[model samples]
Target: MKKSVTILFAFIISQFQAQPGNYYQQSAKYKMNIDVDAEKFTYQGEQTLEYTNNSPDELKVVYFHLYWNAFKPNSMMDQRVSGQGKNGDSRLQKDGVSRLASIPKNEEGSQNIHWIKQNGKELKFEIQETIMKVYLAESIKPNSTTTFTMDWDAVIPQQIRRSGRNNREGVDMTMTQWYPKIAEYDYDGWATFDYIGREFHAPFADFEVAIKINKDYVIGAGGILENPQGVKGYESKPLLSIDKNNKVTWRWTAKNILDFAWSADKDYKVKSFDVPEGPKVFLVYQQNNKTKAWEEAQPYVTKYFQIMNSHFGKYIYPTYTFIQGGDGGMEYGMCTMILGEAQNIKDLMGLMAHEGAHSWYQQMLATNESMRPWMDEGFTSYAEGYTMHQLFPEDLPNPFIKTLDSYRAFIKKGIEEPAVWLGDHHDNGSAYTYASYVKGELYLVQLGYIMGEQKLAEVLKQYYDQWSMRHPSDRDFLHIAQKVSGMDLKWFHNYWINTTKTIDYGIKDIKYDTKSTTIILINKGQVPMPIDFSVMTTDKKIITYQIPLNMTHTWKDKDMYGDFSTMPYWPWTQKEYTLTIPYTKSQLYVLGIDFSQRIADINMSDNFIEVK
Candidate 1:
């Protein structure tokens, strides 16, 4: 009994020590019943929110995000669209005019609260555009729970962004970020921001939602249907197309998820498939000649699951739905909504692969994507490229190079914001796309080159295991990488994310005596990274040399390009390096820096030279 008690005590200490400093995440149980008038594009809802303050500090007030309220004219999102001028989101513009600026009164969306009560006492509140601040009737004590109930009405805007009705793809609804979500509170306090058609940060909570809509419309959603017996053929077949005036109440429940989204269409066709040792996948899309590719790409999604599970991380959710949604793809909770119509199978599979990876990163490893969009968007893009490579080898051997090429083009454009910028704060749409998706993907690819690729693979899986169902900042991800690689990586993450500096390395010079050949490498860019220099011999043999960065304190335990001789450390301050090998120039055919092309070297023209 004494030995057992000692082991148990040590285990508890170890688990506590592994957590981030002062890390406490609060959550709530949201029980809601909504009635939708499909023709009017309006809804009424009643909410019962049971919130708990897990943080050490007591809570005097709380906030909620009224997302649809941004759809009105002169809103912050409308002004932001006009402010970006020609560089704003194209979807939000119509012939150089902001779409929201001229929306019709009835079509415009808004959320109006009737009243809010905390434990049966009415609370005073203030509405700040899309955000609502509620002064508590009674202060919520730490480690204690409080129940609040409210009634509200909402108008669904015409399809413009993720949350809308009647999208370009003819998806009747793309209900995303559609609720009056309670803002997340943690060590950072209340995370409340206006809806600007950007990223989101949500608290993980259980939901018991009952939505009333027309019975004829087939509803596909992110949550499991709790009353499937009542609504027959919901999982595998289309519901009976009956009277539009008749309403059917769909009771859906989800546990430990941040949000729930559902789309309804009379034309939606459902197909179900299972991945071995993985989640059950539901393909719900409107079928037509344009959407034939969705059917052809069904098997590819299974392959994608296999690759992601084998490499990055396991899909923690039991079910994943690929429902046809708005104009483009958006991920939420256990499912993702994507456009079903694709010109080709590869394009369909590519989008599915991208959104599917989000199930692992964005959906489960729920980061405050508004703050660290790179980890959410970039990591998903990285996984997408890798999965596409496996599915279609003829397209490219190393798909990551394609993203590097895109990054180089954007770097040449001379407009790059730091990765630390919030998702909505980027000056232009291009900057946001490149930073969050293109360059963000390069962050992981470069890290793989810095630490061994195997180490990076381990780091991703460990990160998923530790940070899923919670919010992880960029620093949290970096700590996991440092732990897995057993190296000092602060310099790498800081330089890469905090600055717009580029990486440019070149072969400067080569000299040879009868017994030895020497090579000189130069760093032409501001960012400093370890070098993997390789040489080709007269006998057609390729030999690689690894130069460890001084600040890294060590070299990769395993190199993806195979084994190599460890060269002396290269100091970041030094502009050039001279390396000598015990071979004559006559025995060498060529010399190059990073033949794998994994490094995002902005200037690659001078990276290689013939020495024979």
Candidate 2:
């Protein structure tokens, strides 16, 4: 008993020693009250935020994000639309007629000002240019607390992107991010940037929003509605209480969130269901002819929730709203704005699942999106693909759940591109989008293959648990992955994240002697990925091994032996590598390089070698 107790104590000590803490350690708590008049598409809100400055450096200024400014004409975001055509291209001509209309800058506007007593004096402040850097009268000491108040207004723009104004027959509004908000600050400082067509990262806080809208309209927002009394018999009072013309004010509050958004529509049909331990899934679709398709999509959405919660982690929020929006789906905290019209049920489900997964990556694990968009968008895309394959295995061509069919199609069509590229590259827009989404996901899939799923899942969970509300860079993610996988993946990271290299490993030659056999592996492509060689004998026995060729040990090594034979390792430099295996002449029948087809081996036909 004493020996066992000693061993247990030592194990506990080792675990404590190995625990990592530098990723994300701070938590934020805030309170907000929002009042909205839906007819005019104007909202006013007060946010009482309590921020804990956990970093070592003292903070002197706070930054808030004015995201709605992106919709204004001639803004940086508008320049993207103007420079690139409406679909993000400059050469295409406008088609004039569409459901979403582009609003001029003069029509769309937002104002945010704070009045506070700082250092025993009253100070008035106003914000412009999307991100406001407010200088505090007194410095917020490190590891201390501070309270601040903000008053802001948003004039909704015409429905162009995901957040806008529209009065369709079956939909009244699909408002999202239609508010003046604050950016996030962490060890890396404030995340303030002009709105771009990518992802979002916000600081976690509490929200209390009150919205006044037409009595005929049903509202869905980011948080739980606190006033059940107001909702009951809401349509009775036409002139005073709740009327078609007069606005009915509804109050909402959400705790432990980063942002607030809401939607309202008179023709909205609502369906509510609960997950086992997750948030209540609310499916909000148009009450018109689309109800049948929305109803058919419920089971798939529920399956996604189940699979995601079981695989990644539990849904942390209490309620999740899926409302009809424009073009594609966009994710917000606790609420996901999506377009529910799809000819194929599978496509709709896939879109919903992808956006829902973003709730964890972008909404929960709030990494600095402007700097490292891939950490959120890329990872979420990969997770979405995995969830789709898991739920619909028939769509996959292989038993390994790698979706060999889609991968082969992408390769054969010459659509493959490097995963690492600048966000504003001057390539074909379709190619850039493909590389950013598809190839980025492929990179994660390759990472999964490098480290088994169990280890990869553990790393992903740890990443969320540690950096959920913090800003993490690409290096941070790579470090955590290496620590969790117990593998030095610097080569993988360097070649995949920093360069545009392709992977091609094949069987160069095979030699058989009376006593032993030897196989030579060649690096045919520019990139060097860890090779998984499979050796099958005439007797039907198989042996598998991994070859580690990283940047550090790319040169030829004469002394090393065993699983990783003596060979020169070069990353995007050397063309070929030779490996000798010890097997009897009769024992070796065929040898294959990267036999599992896990790596994105660009060339595969030359991967097999036969021994006679």
Candidate 3:
């Protein structure tokens, strides 16, 4: 008994030590000056970055991301879109041919580095497509800071992907990933993957940006505007002051954000609304019949922040913007660039809800998204579904019903990859989209099924309070889940993320005796989950049973859908379990598993056995 107690104490300490705060992440501070030529559709900029090494290991090398370079013909992004053919992004292809290959040279995007210096000494650097690696002349020691300066120029591509100029909607520019951003280095080492038109990951840092452009343009950006009073659409609405150069310098600053993005258009209409106890909301879009949705969405946008904060957590930033510029909708630091045109009010509200929810998971949570796109996209989708249900309660039988069916169909195709696959490495774009977005949402929905719904909400709040603004990994999230639910979630995380497994449970047989009834439940799918079985008698009374997986070591305190008696643990190794209840055959109306419909059981047809 003494030895057992000692081991248990040691294990508890180890688990506590393994929590998220054990590791360190580097930080960056950037100051930039940019000059744009609207007619030529290009820009030149200079940057000075102060990088702090928080890791124990000394850094001998640094890398940067030249994201716009991927818009050039024959680039990796263009090739990937081409290779995927009909299975790839529909925007990149036109009638079975890659549109990137046919784009004119003037429309193709490119970035050129003029010079780079480290601590006043020129450094040797190489550009491999979208990534630039700089060999350090003086390595940065542990806990030391290094300064690097660079001068570069870029031609903004015609609006094809996220960052570009001259979009179809006539927005002048959408500047995201427009600068030569330093690559993030964490415990996993340098994440310098080439930009392949997918997700991104970057260090949490501060940005001070100054842009000199014609005074006629109105801009919406990620950070707080330092010169809002000088701009026409701001609160003061002061007259524009033009210098001899006929240009105005717009200054912006953001703190502890992973990325800085902005959009500019001469005709943009700027509007603002405030969320009570939350951030101020900004809507920047063109004024037209097509953009009427933007004006209508202001109230709904404010309500979204309130709903998300009351349920998920508080919005960390003081302001959020919904800009009209990008191809479809893309989330940024403090703003999201969404297509201005909306089919209707519901369509506009849906997009705003999804992108707004992304601020919690993508902007503040700051997960290494390229490594785990599901954590960002999936969690964002889950929040969006809930927000939509709240905003439009008329369609609230189950918001996740469509997502569950989508995941089941993808699984049936036998082509779905594990959710653990890198965001850009997935073989099929459709598979990647479904796996990361739909299946990832289902992961949370089903967890809410296993634990009670109220407990799941508490777990999410706990996670946000602990991990926000820190670069959290999958283990970090799962650890919070285990701590909150008091259930072992290792098996759950492994089966759902690291492998392509399916969940299918069915009522295989039913038997009646003189005093009671017996039912056989079978696990037809490889993946195992806690079971919620319900039996309805002829008199309309319902009885529910909870069968938890043995791996969890404990079951939920109560069922969310109805009252249920806790049954014995269902050992995953055993494919079938015999469940006995105190009811005769004549008393039975229907016997079903997971009547709540929260579980993603693929074989729902066999889930219920009904008697007339």
lDDT (CA) per prediction: 0.85, 0.65, 0.88
Q: Kindly list the per-residue Cα lDDT of model 3 for residues 59-145, writing each as its tens digit.
A: 999999999888878999889988988878777777656777876899788889999999899999999999999999999998899
lDDT (Cα) of model 1 = 0.85
**Which segments of model 2 are wrong by more than 4 Å?**
1-35, 45-47, 84-128, 167-170, 232-245, 395-435, 510-518, 535-543, 550-575, 578-591, 608-612
Ranking by TM-score: 3, 1, 2
lDDT score for residue 386 of model 1: 87
Which is better, 2 or 3, measured by lDDT? 3
Per-residue lDDT of 81 in model 2:
50
List residue ranges in candidate 1 displaced over 4 A: 1-20, 232-245, 395-397
lDDT, model 2, position 610: 73
lDDT for 423 (candidate 1):
88
lDDT of 2 by residue, 407-505 (tens): 555656664445455454424445555556656666677776666556677878877776665556677778888887777778777776566566777
